[model samples]
Target chain A: MSSILKVQGINKHFGGLHALNNVNLDVEQGKVHAIIGPNGAGKSTLLNCFIGRLTPDTGTVDFDGTSLIGLKPHEINQTGVSRVFQTPEIFTELTLLENVMIPALAKRDGAFKPSLWSSMAGETEIRDQAMNALSEVNMGGKAGMTAASLSRGDKRRLELAMALVQNPKLLLLDEPTAGMARADTNATIDLLKTISGKGLTMVIIEHDMHVVFSLAEKISVLAQGTVIVEDLPEKIKGHPKVQEAYLGGAHL
Target chain B: MTVEQSKKDKIMVIGVVLAVLLGPIILNPFGAGYPDLLQKFVIYGIFAIGFNILFGLTGYLSFGHAAFLGVGSYSAVWMFKLLSMNIVPAIILAMVISGLFALLIGFIALRRSGIYFSILTLAFAQMSYNLAYSVLTPITNGETGLQILHGDPRVLDAAVEDGALPVTNLFGLNMNATADVSLLGMDIQFNAGYYICGLIMIVAFYIALRLFRSPFGMMLKAIKTNQNRLNFTGVNSRPYTLTAFVISGIYAGLAGGLLACTDPLAGAERMQWTASGEVVLMTILGGAGTMLGPILGAGVIKYFENIFSAYNESELMDVFSFLPHWLQELVVSVSSLFVGEGWHLTLGVLFMLIVIFLPGGLMEGFNRLVKLARGGYRKDGASASAAGKVTAE
Candidate 1:
């Protein structure tokens, strides 16, 4: 499979500490790739670099043949790279439908549309697409509910719907199951599986082994700001390097 | 955009029009039906409404909006001095000039948000006020203010008949012209200028209502909620906020122009920080995010400043005539601090009470009254639903 996202020789430093050291990763098209690591493993930092939230010390992040090094977050999103934040970053003051519709409207009209005089009522196409995305996440019934009033799980689902409405090619999920209950995590894994069935590539940074093993076709073990093992999920289970990195080489 | 919303907008427009048209009759009962006070009501109503679009919807409290109002007044006065006595060109020039000023201020102020943004705008306004009072004296006419002069060139106006001072007019309809009608032992005066300002205020209100319902308005509220989410959603919110700032500035300018149209003088004191605070007070007191809130707040504040302040010790004694002598003496001594020249003391206390009790302003008070009138309050469901509606803004 062709690589949809290619990160080569990526390095980032915060003050005197090395955050990401010569990191190299490739996410294949239409595949679920999990980046599993311990705390302070630079997983979120790497994700931030990919989404233009941070500028790396030295690196090349290639998404669909375009360099995402200096682009704004909104510009990077426009290139069909959507991110579901670790903490559900939905518009809390807006309705669930409006929360989903904002990204959809941005996609339809662009980063800036002078829609001052134009009414939003005529945008039936965008509304329908947003509604469909909400239904895909099983949140279609509470479309009119205020986002702030939603439960944590429902807010996560609404945020997922918002990302989905953009119809992005590469979805970056940062700990999609972070703080979720077992049943909710399982439901999320099922939702990810259904999304994967539609042939969308995803890069997930997760701490939960069950979620990582269940959803990821390929797994990469990261520790001390570098990848220690890259292999299939089955092979990663028995990897010596991954165990050493996680257990501090004590039980060799 | 929905049928219900459209109907609501229609009703709001009709209601505002009716109110403005009959202000003379409606306000007569409160002894504030005269042209001068009524004109102040509508002018400041426009000012507060414009201020609300930025502060209410976007949650950006600019403490420098009065600078734009002062700019509009100066521009209108200049137009009157150079062009003609007609108010059309003057008002139009005021809006254009203030819009440009807003563009510059907004471009810089929007770079920093929250308290920083407020500080930047306040600084700009203070600078403008000082310049207008001193350095820009040639344009602003300094501390004495810019007023119509006899030796000036009113290019479009005809020669003054019988050497009388030139008066402002709308295509020969004198703005100062008034019709008095005696009704129920009270005299009602309706001036042409008040009606002109009143009409413009209605138009401004309608535009504000449309803006509140528009998608652009939704985007603004989203910015207020979570600007980071909007940026990540692939939408740039700066231009939207700048547009709101300019639109509001234009509204302030229009109000300023209307002030000039009525009085024919532009003062540097209009740009003072206290003037900006008054508009902020009006918006918050009425209801920042509601359509009717700013206008209601403006009316209340203006009525107290004009009508309530006019009451003397004799009037107070007349009001307290029913009470016993000791009670009257005790009440007058305490209440004296809140009326006459100390009316601001009453306003300050009222403002404090409203902020402490009803943070949502008079609109929230009205909503609670309605809820109480309906069937008394339920425990959780009512407030929860109300909170849901608030967040939906």
Candidate 2:
């Protein structure tokens, strides 16, 4: 399989402390790639670099053969690299349908196109699409409800619907199940598994071992800003370096 | 998209149409039924409606919108001087020129949002005011103001041998010409100028209503809700905001043009910071985000201004004639501070009370009253919003 996203020789530092040290990753197309590590593993920082939320001190992030080093967040998003943040970034003041429709409009119309003459109530196609996406997340009944009224899990699902409405090439799941209860986490995993089955590339940064094992086809173990092992989920499960990286520090 | 909702909206539209059409007759009781004041009502109604589009939809608090009003007035007067006394050219030029002016100011002011954006617009307006007052006097005519002169070349109109200034006209109809009607022993004067402004005001209100339901309007509301998320959603917010700002500016310009069309004069004083502040006050007082709020606010403020400022010591005595002589004297002396020249002080107090008690403006107050009538009264905005929330249970 061809790798859709390739990170090479990444190095980042914050003042005197090194945040990432020569981290490298290869995420194959149409596969679920999970990046697992401890709390300060630089996983989120790496994800931020991918999404253009942060500029690495030195690195080359290649997606679809073009450099993503300096693109604006919106420009990077336009390249079909959409992100689901851990905190769930959605338009809280808008309705769920509106929140979902906005991303769909962006995906269809590109960065900015305001149809002043066309009323939202008349956009039956977009409304249907938004409703379908909402239904996919089981929040179809609440499409008219304000997103601010949604619970934590519902907000995340609504956010997922928002992302999925775009039909992005690469979906970056930043701990999609973080802070979720077991039932909700299991539901999210099943939803992600269904999405993964449809041949969409996803890069998930997760701390939960069960989620990492159940979903990821391939695993990359990260420790102190560097990948310690890159292998199938089965092999990466019991690797000595992976254990040391999870338990100890600074050992090859 | 609900049928009930759409039906209600249709009712509102019909209501607004009726209100605007019958304004002169309805306002006869308020002593604001005169031609000039009625003209001011719809003119400023258009102004506030446009203001709501920006501050209401996108949450951009501009403090320099009066600059466009002033710009419109100046351009209309210039058009009357150079092109024709016909208001069509003047109003059109006013819209176009104000739109361009807004584009220039919005392009710069939109670069910084929140208070910085407001301050930038205020500074630009203050600069425009100062320029029109001092340096641009050749065009603006400085302190004396720019008015149509008898010998000035009104190229479109025939050279008047009568040695009098030409009045603004649409085709052959004079703007200030009034048709008085006696209904139920009360006289109602429908002025040609007032109807011109009134018709335009309806169109403006309708356009604003259409925009509120449009996807573009949704995008604006999204920008207001969360601009960062909007950017991340791959929508460039700057252009949308700039477009809204310019549209609002054009609206202000049209209102200004109508001002000149009714009374063929333009002055730099219209661009004063207080004028800008007044539009903001109207929007907030009516309710910034709702459709009818700003226009309602403009009417209420203008109504109070006309009523309170028209009262003198003698009028006060007439009002308090039932009270004893010494008590009447004391009351009139105390109450006089909030009337006549002190009308602004009354406006200031009302504005503060609205901001404190009804943060959502008159619209929320009306909503709350409706809710109370229906036995569903909630204490505040938070609880009112929360009352409608759908839980997962």
Candidate 3:
């Protein structure tokens, strides 16, 4: 498979602390890839660097063969790379449909026009597209409901729907099932299966072993900012370095 | 999609149209200089509505909006003195100039958020105010204010026609004469200026409504709620916010132009920080993010400022004329403390109370009353529905 994302020699430092040191990652197109590590691992920092939330002191990242260094977060998003925060960063004040519609509207060609006025039904098309996106996660029924009222799992699902609406080329989810209940975690795993079935490229950071094993075709074990092992989940399960770095915390 | 929903929408539209058409007439029945106050209310209401679009919806607190208002007033007055007495051209010029000024200010202020943006706007407004009062005296006419001179040039519509200008009114509507009739023993008279303001306010209101429903508005709200998320979602929030700021500044300019048209004067006081603060109060008191809230807030504030501030001991005595001498005297003496100049004190108290107990402003109180009257099984839920979403952990 062709490489959709390539990270080369990325190093980040916070004063005396080396948060990420010479980390390298490459994601193939249309594959479900998971990154797992201990709490202090640089999983989130790596994700942030990809989305331009934080710039690495030294290194480069390329998305779809385009260099992503020095780009703003929004510019990175515009380049077909989208991320979901650990804590579902959905717009709580807006309706679920509106929450989805916002990203959808941004993706449309004439999103920047000042005087663009559409009829109520035409606006409904935006909502319909949002609903269609939601339907992928089986959340279409909650379209008109306020996003704040949704359960944690539902909010996560809604965030997924919002990301899906953008039709991004690479979706990065940071600890997507971190705070989910056991049932919700399994449901998220199912949702990931559904998403990956569509041949969409995804990079997920998950601590949940059940979820990672259920969805990831390949797993990368990270410790203290650098990748220690990259192998199939079955091989990673038995790797000595992976066990020493992550096995104690894997129950989470 | 439902019949009831469609009917409710129809009612809302009709109610809005009626209010726009007959607001001045219905609000001031006694007419005791109330029409003038009503006009001021509507004009300022339009201004506040525009201001709310930026501050309320976008979570931006601008301290330089009055600069736009002042610029509009100055431009309008200059137009009247140099070109024509007609308000349309003056207002258009005012809006355009204000928008241009906003574009400049927004570019700088939008580089920062929170307190930095506030201070930047304040510094810019203060600079403009000082320039207008001193350095720009040749154009602004200085502290003495700008006025229409008798020998000023007349261009286009200002030209005398058929020995005299053909009795021009707002949009050619007969204002000084209405159906050539009388109502309730008083001649029903309207000024071309009043109609012009009403028409402009209607346009402003419509524009505000369109903006509220637009995708840009949605993005603005998102920016307010979560800037980081919006940035990651591929929206350049700076440009979006700058555009909103410019649009709001134009609205403020239009209001200022209308004021100059009514009074034929533009003064440096219009650009004062206090004036900017007044619009902020109006937006907050009316319900910042709501559509009709700022208008209601402006009406309330202006009513107190103009109508209530004008009431004196004599007016109080006249109101209590039917009462006995001692009671009238007592009433007058007591009421004197709360009238005239005391009106600001009353407003200050009201503003403090609203901010303390009703942070959502008059809209929250009104929504609560509406919920109480509805008396349904979901009454408890309904009251909290319109209140801002309480933070959920």
Candidate 4:
């Protein structure tokens, strides 16, 4: 597969403490890549840097052959890279359908369309697409419900649907199943597997070992702001460094 | 229930339309006595609606919006003095100046959110008010306030007797014509000033309504709800917020200009921080985030401020003179507390009650009542639904 994303010599610092150190990775198009690490291992920091939320002190993230260093997060999203936040950041006051429709509306021709004397029905096709996205994530039944009413897992699912409606080329998932119950986590894993089957490239930062093992085609173990191992899941499971860091960290 | 709700809304719209149409006649029941109170309601309604656009939807408490209002009124009055007695130019200038002020203030205020943001706005407004009170005396006319002068320059419409445009016609209608029509035995006067203010209010309301639902508006809502998530999603919320602030500022400007047009005067008091606080009260009283709420809030407050406050003990005595000596005095004293200077105390208490008991303001309270009347009240456990709705916005 062709490489869709390339990260090189990524380094970040918070005052004197180094958050990320020389982190490098290449994500192939249509492949699911997972980044796993103990808490404080700079996994989120690396993802944030890629999406332009945080600028690395030394490094570059190139997505689809375009430099992402200076672009704003929204610009990066417009460029086909969308991030699903760890916390489901949905418009609480809006209904599920409205939340999905918001991002969809942003994709319409005019960024600022007159809402007065203009019916939302004008965007019937886009609305249907948003609804389809909801259904894809099994949130179709709750489409009319306010976003704040959703269960934690469902909220995450709704957020995923929002990103999917954007039809992004590179999707970043930050602990997608972080707060889900066992059943919900398994469902989320199944959902990710289904999406991966459809040829979408994904980079996921996950803490759940089961989820990380279930969906990731490639695993990268990060510890102390650096990638210690980049290998197949089986190889990662057997790697001594991965065992020493993640296993030891997990035990603690 | 839906049918009943629609009917209620329809009734409200009709009532408002009728009241506005026959405002002067109804206000001055004993002929042309004090129609000024009705005019104040419309003017302040415009102000509160503009203020609500920022504070209500965006969840930004701006304590300096009055500065924009003052800037607008001053600019408008200057326009009338320098150009023509016609209000078009003055109102337009007012909106433009207020919008500019908002742009500058918003840029500084938007740099911070929450309490810091509120303080920044307050400081800017206070600075403007102080400058108007002192340093900008030349333009602002100092403490005595600005009024139209008889010999003021009028380059645009100088009663060109030779071969120029006639008395500045606003949309081809002479502004000072006495055209009164009889409606339901009451003389309804369609004056230029009232129509101009009403037209501006309509336009402002339309623009606000559009902004409330637009993609840009949705983004502001996102910013209000979850700025961090919006950032991660790749949306720069600052520009969106600034744009909303500017739009709201323009609305306040229009209201300020209308105020000047009605009275042909502008005062430094227009930009006081207390005026800013008044709009906040208006928004909370009428229900923030509701389109008609702020307008309703403004009307209510203006009614109390102008009409209720005008009443003294004599007015109460005139109403209940049939009572005995001691009881009549007692009635007048009690009535005085509810109206006039003491009205603000009632406003403050009412505002607090709404904030505590009806946090959603009049709109939410009305919504609940409608639901209850329709037998759609949910069970006790269903409070989750309402809680969810509240948190979502």
Candidate 5:
């Protein structure tokens, strides 16, 4: 499979401290690529760069051969890259259905079309897509409920629904299963597995070993701001470089 | 939308149109039956509604909207002075100019949100006020205000019949003309100017309703709720917010133009920062995010400004006539502080009470009442909606 998102020689700094050090990644199409690391390994910082939340000090991030550097977050998002924030950045005051509809509208309408006169409820196609995305995560029944009333797991699901409804070419998830209960985490993994079967590319930053091992087709272990190893999930388990650089701790 | 939701929307539009058409009759019981007072209510209602479109949806609090209103009034009045006495041209020019003005100010002021945005708007409005008061005297006429004079160019007007001040009109329909009808022993005066302003306000309210139900509005609310998420959602909030700001600015302009049509004068005081703050109070006092809240807030505040200020010591004596002489004297002395010249104190107290008891504004108060009437079902949603409004900052 061709690489859909290619990163090379990405470096970032905070004063004297190096946050991301000459990192490189090649995410393939139609696969779940997991980035695993200990805390402060620059996994989130790297994800932020992908979504244009932070600019790398120096390097290139090419999505489908288009450079993503210096683009505003929304501009980057408009280029078919959608992100699920670690903390589930859902619209707290809006309904779940409405929450999902926004990104769908954004995806179809581009950055700004000024769809001022069109009634949002009248966007039947987008609405149906949003509903389908919601029920995909088992949230179709509570579409009318305000998002603020959602539990953390449900908020994460709604956020996932929001990202999915966009039909993005590349999905970046920052800790998709972080803070989820065991049952919720397992359900999310199953949901993600089904999504990956549809031939969508996703890059996930995760701490949960179960989620990582279950869903990731290829694993890239990040340690000390650089990729220590990149290989199939089966090979990644006992790779001595990954074991020494990251997995050397009690985690299997 | 569901059948019930659209049905409610239809009813709401019908209700607003009917209320505006029958404003004089409806306001008669409240002692605001006169055409002039009713004009203020409708005009300011338009102002507040437009203000709410900005402050309500996207959570951008602008303290410089009065500048747009002032610009609209000046544009309309200029149209009258240079072109015609017809309000159609005046109103159109007013909206267009104010929309441009909003685009300029909104472009600059919308750069930083929250308190910084508000302060930037406040500064812009204050600067405009100072300019209109002094530097722009050639156009604005300074403290005396711009007025059409005898022999002044009114190219579209038919040669100023015997130097009588030209009355504002819509295609020769007299704006200042009024007719009185007695209903149930209460006299209600319906002025042509009031009806024109009333019709325009109804249209404005309808547009606001459509905007509220639009996808653009949802995007705006999303920005208000979580802009960070919206950015990642692939929507650029700047243009959306700028559009809302311009639209509301145009609303303020429409209100300003109507104010000019009502009296045929545009003054610098109309652009004062305090005047801008008044729209903020009107929106918050009504319920910033709700459809009908700002109009209701404007109506209540204007009513207090006109009626409460009309009260005097004699009115107090008549109201307290039933009490004993000593008690009446004591009551009048105490009550007098809250009326007449001190009516602002009464308004302030009332405003404080509403904000404290109903942080969601009068809409929340009505929601509570409606919930109470329905045995308090869906109890969580009332507080949920209220919580939505309180997070506007």
Candidate 6:
């Protein structure tokens, strides 16, 4: 498969601490690529660089051959890269349907459209699409509920639905199931598998090994501020370098 | 819009139109049917409505909106000075000039959010007020304000009509010209200026309603809810916020223009922070995010400022005359602080009460009352309580 997202010679620093040191990654098209690391492993920092939340001191990030190094977050998103945030950054005050509708509107209207005179009610197609996205995440029944009133797992699902509504070419998720219970995590894994079956490309940053093992077509183990291993999940499971990186060379 | 949303919008428009049309008759009972006060009601209602478009919808607390209002007034006055006494040219120019001014201010102020945005707007407004008062004295006339004078050049049409100051008019119809009628022992005066202001306010209300139902409005609410999420959703929030700011600024300008239409004066004091604060108070008191809240807030505040503030000790005594002498004396003494020149104290107390008890403003209180009338508190009470917390920021 052709690589859809390419990161080369990426370096980021927060004062004296080097958050990312010459990190290189290539996420192939139509695959679930997971980046797993222990605490303070710079996983989130790397995700931030890709999504324009942080500007790497030196880097080249190319999504579909377009440089995403200097683009704004929204502009980058417009380039067909949508991100599901770590802590489920849904529009909590808005309804679940609205939370999904917002991204759909953004996708249809571009980054900025002065549609002041146009009624949101008339956007039946967009609304249907948003509802479809919500249903895909098992949130269609609670579409009218205010998002803040939703449980933490449902909030994560709603956020995932929000990103999905954008129909992005590449989806970036930061800890998609970071705080979910085991059942919710399993459900999310099933959801991810269902989505991946549609041939969508995703780059997920996760700490959960079960999730990493279950859905990831390819696993990239990150240690300190660099990728220590990049291989299939089965190979990554028994890789000595990754084990040493996680276990600090202690026998397991 | 959906059938239901459109129906609601239609109802709102009709309700506003009726209120504006029958305001004189309706307000007559309250002794606030005078042309001047009615004009103030519609004018400030427009102002508060416009302020809500920004603050209520987008969650951007602009403390410098009065600058646009003042700009609109000055532009309208200048239009009258240079062009003619026609209210059309004045109002149009006022909206355009204030829109441009808002573009400039919004471009700068929208760079920051939260309290910093408020402070930035405040600084810009204060600067405009000072400039209009001092450096721009030649145009603004400083402390005295800008008004049509006898010797001023009026290139369009006649400079003077019958050797007196030319009154502002719409195609020869004088704004100050009033038609008085007595209905059931009550005097009702309908002035040309008040009707024009009222009509414009109806249009403004319609526009505001359209804005609220529009996709643009949803995007703004999203910005208020989670701007970061919006950004990641491929939506540029800055332009949406700036647009909201400019739209509301133009609304303030329209209000200012209406003010000039009724009174034909432009003063630097109109740009003062206190004036800006008044619109904020109106929006919050009425309900920041809800339609009709700001206008209702404006009416209540203006009613108190005009009618309640005029009551003297004698009026107070007359009101409490049914009580015993000692009780009446005590009531009048205590109520004295809330009426006449001290009416602001009453308004302040009311503002405090609303903010403390009903943070969603009067609309939430109204909603709660309706809910109570229907039944008791519902399960969605948590969400109802959570509504104001997000937008209040």
| Fraction of the reference Cα-Cα interface contacts (below 8 Å) that each candidate reproduces | 0.50, 0.61, 0.32, 0.26, 0.68, 0.73
Residues B7-107, model 1: lDDT tens digits = 77788788889999989999999888999999999999999999999989999999999999999999999998999999999999999999999999999
Per-residue lDDT of B169 in model 3: 36
Off by over 4 Å in 5: A247-252, B381-393
Task: State each model's TM-score restricted to chain B.
Answer: 0.94, 0.95, 0.86, 0.85, 0.95, 0.94
Per-model C-alpha RMSD: 2.4, 2.7, 4.1, 4.5, 3.2, 3.2
Estimate, for each residue in B270-321, the C-alpha lDDT of model 4 and write its tens digit: 9999998888888889999887888878877876676667778788899889
DockQ of each: 0.52, 0.51, 0.32, 0.29, 0.52, 0.57
lDDT of 6 at A5: 96
**Model 4: residues >4 Å from true position, as ranges?**
A108-121, A249-252, B1-16, B22-34, B160-192, B314-338, B379-393
DockQ for model 5 equals 0.52
- Assess candidate 4 and give its TM-score to the true structure: 0.88
| Clash count, predicted structure 4 | 5
Give the Cα error of residue B52 in candidate 4, in Å.
Answer: 2.1
Model 1 TM-score? 0.96
Question: TM-score for all predictions?
Answer: 0.96, 0.95, 0.90, 0.88, 0.96, 0.96
- What shift in Å separates residue B240 of candidate 6 from its native position after superposition? 1.1
Give the alpha carbon lDDT tens digit for every residue of A17-72 in model 4: 89999999999999999999899999999998988888889888999989999887
Q: Which residue pairs in model 2 clash with each other?
A: none
Model 1 whole-model lDDT (C-alpha atoms): 0.89
Q: Rate the local accuracy (lDDT) of all candidates.
A: 0.89, 0.89, 0.80, 0.79, 0.90, 0.90
Positional deviation of residue B53's Cα in model 5 after best superposition, in angstroms:
0.8
- Model 3 over residues B74-174: C-alpha lDDT tens digits? 99888877776666778889999999999999999999999999999999999999999999999898999988665666575555534532332344453
Mind giving the per-residue lDDT tens digits that candidate 5 earns over A1-252?
Answer: 899999999999988979999999999999899999889999999999998989999999999888999999999998889899898789998888889989999999988878778897589889889989998888887777789899898999998999999888998988888778889898999999988999989999998878899999999989889888899999988877877775455455
Model 6 ranges off by over 4 Å: B381-393
Residue A112, model 5: lDDT of 86
lDDT of 1 at B28: 93
